[model samples]
Target: MNLKNLAAAALFAAGSALASLGVPHAAFAETTKLKVGYLPVGVYSYFWRAQDAGYFADENLEVELVPMAGGGQIIPALQSGALQFGISDALGVLNARKGGLPVTYVSFNFSQSSDNPVHAVLTTNPDIKSPKDLEGKAVATNLSYNTDWTMMREWLRKNDVDIDKVTFREIPFPDMLPALRNDTVAAVGAVEPFVTFGKEQGANVLGHYFTDVKSPVVLSGIVAMLPYVEENPDIVKGFVKAVNRAIEDFKADPAVARETIGAHTKIPATAIEAMNLGDWETEVPPSEMQFWVDAAEKEGILNETDDLNSLVWSPKE
Candidate 1:
């Protein structure tokens, strides 16, 4: 089904579920309205789950989950006050901070670990057996300087592959598989659902790039402008609490998670069922932030370092 139809179905399902729970729509006398921007992907199922299950309502929040194309679009919207909050990769958030955007991560979202690797380097070429084999070949990522691209570059670098010799192409997640199939790109740095899709299409995984760098690294999280967070600390805390509740629900019920994911993302049920959903965390540790900080410095993405503590938002006692 198309994305629009799937989204409609998801909303209908959410409404039905909420109705069955006997939760009236006007239960709360005072509700904080929020516009949260996020990329439409399976990993972001927590947002949909939270909204659908009345977790946000339980926190007295009326959230409008805005589906965005990428961080590029989301970041600008957040800056222009079009969105109150946005979900972004750790790298993107750090980069934004370096560029002087007062955004801080309010809560962690998705994580990648060695045991449950959710991101992979997939290639259809028979001769490309390892990372080194792609030294002179082209690889596709959703975007340059994105989490996938940075992790893939680090993985290739650690594997003794000359990354300078490798050509990087920015193909959207949905287009990566076709790019690989047609040999438009030698390989693709793909995340879940797409990783499962690529394997189903006979593509071989060269490696789980993110895990290769470090097991259990924070990939992305929910971010908000510092000013908004400071002014509305209660709203930020409520958002984190609601999402944390949803994350717990997501972990406890895999079937419902898949259904919610399939309804929101364009991935088919078969691939969604097969894909590894990876890990979710409510807390974004300072060490995890430092890992990206060190990485950015090494990659010359950041010249001056910033305080890691300041990058994350916490409620004042």
Candidate 2:
């Protein structure tokens, strides 16, 4: 062959090698590094699932999942730019907005379902049979003014229990079981797999607080600062797509969900298997935010409410 013909053959071979290696000519060469904050709980397993299942990578994203204590820390981290994204409860997001911190929900995380309840009021004391029994008792929650705290208070009130008579303590989820076992707290607002683990340690479920009030309540979801979301809409869209894909995969296979959750959390296999996971969803409706807003206003948690639609960030087509 002539030199020009030989060069043409080499170029053809180079293109074939690139195609064989699955390398696109116009590939997304840059990956957006995202520091994502999350509460290390079984319900937020989809974050780990998305990372482990390569959904985030598929979107050209490098997600660093930072395990946070609760929304209390996560919200501030988001505000200060320490975290680009975070998973926070609806109440936390709304409260932050109420306080003039421009944070908004970008995608759904998980919901509390009647069929598969994850959050509950648990007690180890045999004498504490009902909510009214804890008139002068202290109850542990992950944080004050959080979803669990708010719901448990509402649960107590619904049962005709005096709100002022009960005292709430802020304790992490892992420590709640020990606190209950040693009688440090009369009861705990437990989320799984602690709910299941607590039962294994002799704690009994007083009631499913979240589901008792309403079935399929929007619990928490992906959140970010409004400025970040507005400036980087594509990044936000990619994140939403990745998380939603992960949710679908998580729902399709229970075993995979268990494995993914167990890998991220310290829960034992038995507890993970026995525990009911949250109902993960992909969409966050304005009505769901309204539920929390109305509840917060009634409880005097929020003095005034904002338009629910403004609190959520919807991706433009």
Which candidate wins on TM-score?
2
| Tens-digit lDDT string for candidate 1 (1-51) | 999999988877777788789966445337889999997787888999998
Summarize candidate 2's per-residue lDDT along 74-117 as a digit string, tens digits.
99999899999998888898789889998888985588788899
Local accuracy by lDDT, each model: 0.86, 0.86
TM per prediction: 0.89, 0.90
The TM-score measured for candidate 1 stands at: 0.89
lDDT of 1 at 165: 100
Off by over 4 Å in 2: 1-26
* TM-score of predicted structure 2: 0.90
- For candidate 1, the per-residue lDDT at 168 reads 93
Q: Evaluate model 2: give its lDDT.
A: 0.86
Error of 2 at 114 (Å): 1.6
